[model samples]
Target: MSTYEASLASAAAFMERHERFLVINHVNPDGDATGSLLGTGWLLRQLGKQAVLVNEGSTPEKFGFLPGAEQIINASRAEKPEFDAVITCDCADFARIGDVKEWLPLGMPLLNIDHHPTNDLFGTDNLVRTDAAATAEVLYDLLTYMKQPIPQEMAVCLYTGLLTDTGGFRYSNTTPHVMEMASALLACGVEPAPIAERMLETITKAHVRLLQRALQTLVLRDTDQTAYLTITAADMEQCGAQNDDTEGLVNYARNIEGVEVGILYKEVASDKVKVSLRSRSIVDVAAIAQSIGGGGHVRAAGCTVHGTLADAKQIVEQKVSAALASQEASV
Candidate 1:
C-alpha cells in the first residue's frame, strides 16, 4: 500500500477506538477548513460515531450554503461537549484552535490532519502532507480508507474547498496528483461551474463597493513592484461590508503586472488589524506572516496585529518593503 493508504489505515484504526469526537479548525477558517470539517463529519456519521464541529468563529456568509455548516458550533459559545478524542483539520499549530483549545481535555487523544508544511505535529496522531494542494485532498483519502461513501453533498463540500484553496487550479501547488483527486471527486457528480460562480464569480453590491474602496487605497512601493491595500474600520462601515467581503482583495494586488507581492490590511476589531498577504513569485509571504505572529504557506499567509490600523499598516509595509528589497538585491 502507498504511504497515503498506510496513513489512512492508521488514522482509521485510531478512530475506530473512539466513541465521541470533537472536530475543530483554525481561526478565520477558509474554504479548506470548512470543506475538510464537513467531509470528515460526514464520514464519521457514516461510522455511527458521535462527532461535533467546533470552529473559532462563524462561517463566512458565502459558504453558508455548504451542507452540515449549521452543525458547527462556535468554540467560544459551546458548552464544552465531552468527547473521547479531538480532531483538528487544516490547522498548522495548536494556537490556531483559538477558543476551542479550552474544550480539549488534558491528556486526551488529539488527531491533527493538515497539508501545511509548518504543522507542529502536536497530536497523538499526525497526518500532515506538505505536498497536498488542499486539506480536502487528505480528507478524500481518509474517507476512502475508512470505506465511507462520498455523497453528492459531500462532493460539493470537498469540491468547493479544493477549487478555492488551489485558486481554481491556477496556483503553483496544484499538481497532477491534485488534479487526479479532483477528478475522483468529480466522478461523484461534482460540477465546477456553479461552484466557481458561487465562490468566486458571485458578489454582492456592497462587496463590490467595498472592493472598490479598498482598491482605491492601493499603494505601490519599491519601484512599483509591491502593491498593497489597507481598510480601516471606518472604510468597512462606509461601504456597509463585513469582513468576509474582503476575502479576495489581496489577489487583486498580486495580479498586477509589476507587483511581486500583495497585502491587505483590514481592521478586524478594536485595536486589532487582520493582514492577508499574497506573493506572485519568489517572495515567501508565510515568512512575513510568521514575523508578524502568523503563519501559512509560502504563497498565502495571514496574521493579526494588535494595534490601530494605521500602526499595523505602517509596520507591515515597512517590513515587507525591506524583505522585498533584500530579495531584489540577492537576485
Candidate 2:
C-alpha cells in the first residue's frame, strides 16, 4: 500500500479499536477546525462510537448554525471523560489544542488529522495531507475509505470547512480536487447559498466597528509589497467585538493593491500578540510562522509572540521584510 493508504488504514484501525473518543480542535477554532471536529464527531456517532467534541474556546456565534455546534463543550465545562482515544482535527501541533490537551487520558492513542504542510506528525496515526485544501477534505476521503455515509448534516459541516478555508473558493489552495469534493458535498444535500451567506456575507455592526479600528492601523512596507494592521484588546472591547469578530480583518491589508503579504497583529492580552499572515503568492508564511513556533499553510499562517504589541510588530516586520527581499532576490 502507498504511504497515504497505509496511514489511512492505521487511522481506520485505530478508530475501530476505540469505543470512546475525545475530539479536539485548535484554540480559537476557525471554520475548518470547527467543521472537521464536528464532522468527525458525527462520523464517529454513525459508527456507534461515543465522541465528545471539545475546544479551548467557544464556538463563534456565526458558526453556531452548524448541525453539531451546540454539542461542542468548552474546555472549562468539560470533565475528564472516560475517553479511550483522542483525535485532533485541523491542528498543526499539540500546543494548538490549548488546555484541552491536559484532560486527555495518559497513553491514549492520538490520531492527528490535518491539511497543514507544517504538521509535526504529532499523532500515533498521523494523516497530514498538504495537498488537501482543508482537513474536511481529508476527513471526506477517510470517511469514504471507512465506508461511512456522508449524511446531509455531515456534508454541511464538511462543505463549510472547504468554503471558509478557501476564502469562498478564492484562495490558491482551491484546487480541482477541492472543487470535486465540493460538488460531491452539494450532491449530498449541502446547500451552498445559505452556508455562504452565513459564513461570508453576514456581518454585524460590532464586527464592522472592529474592522474600522483595525483599518486605522494599517501600514505598508517593503515598497508596498507588505501591508499589516493591528488590533488591541482595548479596541475589541470598545467595539463590543468578540474574539471571532476579528476574523478576516487581515484580508483588508492583503486586498490592497501591490501588497503581496498581509498581516494582522492582534493583542490578545497585555503582553501577548497573535499574528496572522496572508500572502497573495511567492512567499511561504507557514515557514515564517513555524520559525516562531506556529504553523499553517503556505499562503496563510499564524504565530503568537509573548511581548508588547510594538515589540511583536517590529519583530514580524523585520521577518516579513527579509522574506520579501529574499523572494525578490530569487526572481
Candidate 3:
C-alpha cells in the first residue's frame, strides 16, 4: 500500500475502534469545513456510532440545505461530553477548532482529517492528505477504502466540500482525480446545478450591499500587481451583513486580469482586523500569511491581525509587497 493508503487503513481502524465520536471543524467555518463536518457526522451516525457534531458557530445559511446541518451544535467549552474520540475535519490545527478542546477529555484520541499542507499532525492518528483537494476528497477515499456506501444526503455534503474548496473546480487543485470524486458524488444523487446555483449564484441583499461598500474602499498597488479592498465594521453594520456574507468578496480583487495578489481587510473590532489574501500564481500567499501568525493554502490564505484596520492593512501590504518583490527578484 502507498503511504496514503496505509494512513487510510490506520484511520479506518481507528474509527472502527471507537463508538462515540465528537466531530468538529475550524472556527469561521467555510464550505469545506462545514461540508466535511456534516458529511462525517452523517457517516458516523450511519455506522450506528453515537456522534455529536459541533462547530464554533452556527452553520452558514447557504449550507442549511446540507443533510444534518441542523444537528451541528454551537458548543461551549464548559459542556464536557462523553466521547470515545474526536474527529476533526478541515481543521489545520487544534487551535483552529477554537476552544472546544477545553471541553475534551485530556489525551482523548484525535483523528485529524484535513487537506491543508500546513496541518500540524496534532491528531493521535493523523490522516492529513495535503495532496488531496479537500477533506471531503480524503473522506471519499476513506469511504471507498472501507467499502462504505454513500447516501444522497452524504453525497450532497461531500460534494459541497469538493465544490467550494476547489473554487467550483476552477482552482489549480482541481485534478482529474478531484473530478472523478466529484463524478462519483454526482452519481450518488447530488444535483450539480442546484447546489452550484445556491452556493455561487444565490446572494442575499446584505451581500451585494456589503460588496458595494467594500469595493468603494478598493486600493490597487500597481507596482506590486496587487488589488485590495476593505470592509469596515461600520460597513457591515450598515449593510447588516454577517461574516459569512463576506465569503467570496476577496475573489473580486483576485479575479481581475493583471492582478497577481488580492487582499481583503475586514475590521472585526476597533483594534482587530481579519486579513484574507489570494494570489493568482507567483506568490505563496500561505507563507505570507504564516509570517504574520496565520496559515492557509498556497494561492489562498488568511490571518487575523490584532491592531487597527489601518495598522492591519499596512502590515499585510508590507508582507505581500515584500513577497512579490522577493519572488520577482528570485525569478
Best by lDDT: 2
Instruction: Show model 1 residue runs off by greater than 4 Å.
Output: 1-6
TM-score of 3: 0.96
Q: Give candidate 3's whole-model lDDT.
A: 0.88
Residue runs of model 2 more than 4 Å from their true location after superposition: none
lDDT of 3 at 124: 93
lDDT of 3 by residue, 183-283 (tens): 98889999999999988789889999988888888788957399999999999899988889998999999888899999999999999999999999899
Range of the 10 consecutive residues with the lowest summed lDDT in candidate 1: 140-149
Provide the overall lDDT of each model, using Cα atoms, as 2-decimal numbers.
Answer: 0.85, 0.91, 0.88
**TM-score per candidate, chains pooled:** 0.93, 0.98, 0.96
Q: Write the per-residue lDDT of candidate 1 for residues 1-331, one digit (tens) a residue.
A: 8776777777897788898999998887888899999887887888889999888788777778888899998877658887899889999889999878877778889888998866778899887787788889888778766677788899988988899889888899998888988898899998888888898788787778878888788888878878888787888888888767788888888899989889888887779999999998888888888888888899998888999888887888887888888897998
Off by over 4 Å in 3: 76-78, 222-224
lDDT of 2 at 164: 95
Task: Give me the displacement of residue 308 in model 1, in angstroms.
Answer: 2.6
* Structure candidate 3, residue pairs in collision: none
Q: What is the C-alpha RMSD of each candidate to the true structure, in Å?
A: 2.0, 1.0, 1.4
